[model samples]
Target: MTIYGYRIPMMASLIVWCILWEIVGRLDLLLLFPPFSDVLVALGDVVNSRSFASAVSITLYSYAWGLGLAIVFGVALGFLMGTVPVADRLLNMWVNVFLSAPLSALVPVIMILFGMGAPTVIVTVFMFAVWIIALDTRAGVLHVPASLLEMARSFGASRWTTTWKIVLWAAMPEILAGIRLGVIRGVKGVVIGQLLVSIIGVGALFTTYSNNFLMEHFWALTLILFAFALTVGQLIALLEARIDYYAGARS
Candidate 1:
């Protein structure tokens, strides 16, 4: 960020927002907005509680399973769509439709199909995340330089060998970009799933806190979720940066 020819750190803006929140909270602008300090204290308390631990574990477990499957299938399908025109022609419209659709509405059908459990939550996360990853990966693969593919063919590289060694490497930057975006979406998916499916895990905590008007606890839990998403996003962004060479060279 910058202002008046001076650069501002990212955390500076966060601090500003925190101050505004604290002011509003102190003034009782909204009963739902608790004081930042009180929220911090509640956060500390929740962090040590067994319920919190269990909730975190359950949420993370579902997140991992969903994201893992998303990556595997997303990348594979993306590769196929990128390399095979027939496949892309067949599936492109459906993929675009899913990406543009309100996937949340499908949760009820998922619940009916999968039943009320972690499986529903996992599927929700996957549904929310997989499409964007596949799209980004496909775009990346399509952008791989034709010369590179010709070089691989000139070297007598088999289809599999060219795909893994040349095409995959060339698309690594955008693939990582897709994964990072998918992860952020997955966080939203997990929350939505838990809240709608059975109110298990962190959803339960949110329900209890909000129903009882425990604003501090509710905001504290929200902050934790936001932090988790931000941390994972930054990590993946760093990994993407490390593969910047591919993007630059391809261009």
Candidate 2:
């Protein structure tokens, strides 16, 4: 809906929010809460600054590397587990354990083992995001139609050929969903890494601003996180839509 050349729904809500914040902030509801205008200016400055760029870049670097590793390992492990009962039984328990363990709680131990660096952060992200993907892939394998496998076998397709060409194709849709989720997890890991593991990126700046009670800077870092996460999410959604289109055409 549009009203006065602005989205009525979103614009109206924003107007109401700004008015409420201005009123409350001017009324001195809290010492910690800075005025909205201060936050917007700080956010604008942070976005254009070098510190923000470095923090964002480092975090994305770790996230990308970690996510890549997870996709490789997770898909391989999931394929094996889905195909071989023994492999499934052997690793399922440990995967469950890792999945249940909170990443925040494990950060200290990871730091102790890995010391302080990007490696620890990357490792943390991979460990947390891999299992969901692995499980999804396994489900895809399990759900592959027996008829297709049989048809391939009857046509003299070797076991390897049938497994790769037929079984793997059937599982891809589910696996894609898992990949989207894994990327989100990776983004979170990157943010956490910035905060906890040596704090070289936005997280460190967030801490500095926080210590000095610069609420604007703290909020600014949070805004960066939102933007980064949203960008990744949008990319994933676009990819998913394309995949769906291709799959639909084939079907």
Residue range 61-178, candidate 2, lDDT tens digits = 7788889999999888889988999999999888778767787778878888987888888887887789888987887788777777788988999989987887777788777877
lDDT of 2: 0.78
Tell me the spans in candidate 2 whose CA falls farther than 4 Å from its real position.
1-37, 245-251
Ten-residue region with minimum lDDT total, candidate 1:
196-205
Among the numbered candidates, top TM-score falls to 1
What does the lDDT come to for candidate 1? 0.94
C-alpha lDDT of residue 172 in model 1: 95
